[model samples]
Target: MLKDLSPQAFFMGLLTAFVGFASSFAVVLQGLKGVGASDAQAASGLMALSISMGLCAIVLSFSTRLPVSIAWSTPGAALLVSAGAAVGGFNAAVGAFIVCAILIVIAGLFKPLGRAVAAIPAPLANAMLAGVLVGLCYAPVKAVSFNPAFGLPIVLAWLVVGAWKRLYAVPAALIAFAGVLAFGVDIPEGAFASWAQSLGPTVLLVKPEFHLASIVSIGLPLFIVTMASQNIPGIAVLKVNQYEPNPGPLFATTGLFSLFSAPFGGHAVNLAAITAAMCAGEDAHPDPARRYWAAVIAGIGYVVFGLLAGAVTGFVALAPPVLIQAVAGLALVGAFSGSAFAALKEPETREAAAVTFIVTASGVTFAGISGAFWGLLAGGLAMGLARVARR
Candidate 1:
């Protein structure tokens, strides 16, 4: 392992961790808060997720000698945002998180279960994810409306940098957001004291509260999105790069970490889709076998960032909510585009997919269930009827 270490691998590893964390943490924070977490609880959740995913990545890379990157479920967080507060609030959400983690573990251990998730119509799954993202995707424009002086620069930074180098665009937006917060936004008197107090990291162990509504609304959708958008794609990326580590154990390992973190208020952790490409690609190292070192280093980097979760969360907390949301929106544009394209690509399923997308994006709630579950249900019905008509 020592012999495999190289400067290129180290740099790529650090870059991957930095990009992965900086780009979408606001989404995570917002998701936690959306599900009724207090500021302290949200910070704890963020810290728990960061540390769990980081350790999962490290253990997997070292054990399998494959660049298996783990990350918090960004799409799952987006699902929470759409779901709003759970019927029973944060504790209920935490219970749902645990249930999702257990399901992930079961999927890994049981072949049929994993296959069942994979068997969900691709169009419906993609459409559902696309719908979940709609509200957040509108944040940039809304931010501009709220305060052009504060929001325009962030959008411009993302656009200009994205045009030149797509990967760094969100980070650029994040930096611009920081600039706006520091200079443009008004700080309430005594905010400095609060910010200072928040700098020290804290973790709270939340007791899980099981509620059928939360399980249906948040848990089930979170599990599906994490599997479809993150875990499955992550494995595909590794395979495309010619590394074929067994997926079952890797999924199980991440699920275990998710379970461990749930009591600390974290949502699901799963295989990283985007950053996995960075660690598995040739850019990490010319030799494929040694690329695992990059993932290991990236894991280390994530752990370091996890330690600073308090400060990061505190700083962002002081910013205007729209500004922070603008950054989150910029971070997810790529995901939204990809999921939307995938959902609509197949002519046969296009109508059903559209139904799913519309329903999910509507952000409707009925009988204590979020639209995500209903969207999938409606799309499935639409698809079934379409098939029957053809028959």
Candidate 2:
């Protein structure tokens, strides 16, 4: 297996891990805080998610010999941010997360459920994912308006690198973001010592407290959004790249990992959608057969990044939130573009796709559930009506 390793694959793996962490890990941290996680609990969540997904990726890649990337559910995290606090606070939210995980596992183990998940119309799923990305994708333009000096450089870096090679664009923007942070702002000489000291994850646990409200609102919707938005798109990406790993086992393994992680304040973990392209695509390696190394290396990278989760939190705390957001936004544009294209690619699904995208982007809240859920519901309803009208 190691014989397949190449320099191209190695750096690509490194790049994948770098972009993956820098893109939305901050959002993950914020999501934990929204659920009323104490600072320590939030740290524990980051560490747990990082380690869990890392191990998941490593094992899946090696076992299946496929680049089966795993990631914390970004949309689910967003859902937690919106409704978790309202649904009985942190412990209840933890229970909701566990419930979501368990549901994912059941969905995996049960063939009919697996078929049902797979049966979700691709357009609606794409539209829902696009909607989720819209808020994030707009961040760069928003950031530049807020701070041209800081944000413009990142934008320019992204544009230039994107023109050269699309895959490298986000990483280039990240470097530019870091450069701006490093030189544009002054750092105390002594703080470096403090920064050094705060590396590696600290363990903390939240005892879960389940409630019907939390289950109906946060758990069910979280599972639906994660499956619809992340896993479905993830499988599509792998298929496009000529890799087809079994879906049932993928879902089951990630769900189990997520279940294990919940008590430690981690949210959902699942098949990766966006960064899956980075590791699975031709850019990761010339020989498609050997791309598994990229994912394996990425797994190692995620673990290493997990060790620095504490430091990453501190670094984000030090920077302007808008700046971090700007960088994060830069990273997600590619995903938004792909999802949007997929949503609207077919003429028949256009109306339903538009409905999904608008509702999701609107961020409307009702019945203690998030717009991602409502968006999909609205889109599906629209689709059904359109079919009836046709009949």
Candidate 3:
């Protein structure tokens, strides 16, 4: 099956899968902790994410014949960890998931809000995206501080590949991984060995209880963040690539998936920007008809990894923290730059976008929600009010 694919298509798919796998490791760990999951449960959550996103990617790819890679909702995952830690534990988190699903279904059904989000000015939407990505860059930079030995090599790999203009199209991450191996970095002896030891998995089938508090705290916030931060920009990415998937179904499907998987500790699911970009690019498949296989491969990878959640967690834990951080930051550089440029491009929107960028990057939380959502809301409102006054 792989042999018929062009070299670019094959490599793009491979790169998308690798990035999708690595990017979610830390956030998954946080999700497990939110629900007070044991080591095994925590690992299972990671596996669940891998499986859900992987399967989604595969189905969407093959069906659409586009390089549409699905990924665990990064914002949703981060929110889950943060909110789940604060609220009534896993039960509350589950409540949030249900609420998010309801909201998504409504959005799909309503038509107006879905269209509004899709219709947001491209510059403004991109500005909001840049604001959202501000913090993501820190992960890799911080990773360097945590484990310089491992982190340094990864950074060097990015630099080397970046400097070598000839290999510009080669995945910087693949190069980074090779650099890490070349450095002869010591892998913990027990890291690989632990795969053989099975901790009798305890699966908690959470019966989601509806609580007003949980709904307000988790559900409402998750819906907002997922929509504002993840889904909106996701649609933008698709549009940017000229794929133009129907936003209603796409949003509805992701929400439905999250609703079903929340009890199993799966965070939000949405379209993947960076990974999707890999397959959507001209380099991936010029013909466009063949690019979808990359996503199919990704979805298959997710399901396989999710079943082995324990092993996935162990593997992540075993890797040097710096390495994880470095890889994350490097991977997000393009996103960060894109966001910043978007935020500053328009003379009229600059101030509001700047405010959004600052507030979001500050990482402040109020009323049980993170700064990203609030930042965008506040900035957008400010811009709106200013326009009204001038008019």
Which candidate wins on lDDT?
Answer: 1
Winner on lDDT (1 vs 3)? 1
Candidate 2 lDDT (Cα, 0 to 1):
0.82
Span of ten consecutive residues with least summed lDDT in model 2? 78-87
Candidate 1 per-residue C-alpha lDDT over 256-317 given as tens digits, one digit per residue, 9 for 90 to 100 = 99999999999989999899999999999999989998899999988888878888888988
Candidate 1 global TM-score: 0.99
Per-residue lDDT for 1-391 in model 3, tens only? 4653676776677666766775556555654565456566566556666777777777666666667778776655554444435356666666667777778767776898676655655445555455555555666667567666666666776677777741242246545644674454576667556755743332456656666666665666566656766677677777787777877777777767776677766656777776777777777777766777767766776676566666556555555555554555565566568657866889888877877767666666676565656666777887898799889
Candidate 2, residue 41: lDDT: 83
The clash number for model 2 is: 0
User: lDDT (0-100) at residue 122 of candidate 1?
Assistant: 90
Off-target runs (Cα >4 Å) in candidate 3 are 1-12, 30-39, 62-67, 78-84, 119-132, 162-195, 198-225, 228-244, 281-286, 319-323
Which runs in model 2 stand beyond 4 Å of their true positions? 1-12, 78-84, 186-196, 240-244, 277-291
Give each model's clash number: 0, 0, 9
* By TM-score: ranked, best first: 1, 2, 3
In candidate 2, the residue pairs with backbone N, CA or C atoms under 3 Å apart (3 or more residues apart, or in different chains) clash, namely none
lDDT tens digits, residue span 72-93, model 2: 8987775565554746789998
The RMSD of every model to the true structure, in order and in angstroms, is 0.7, 2.9, 4.5
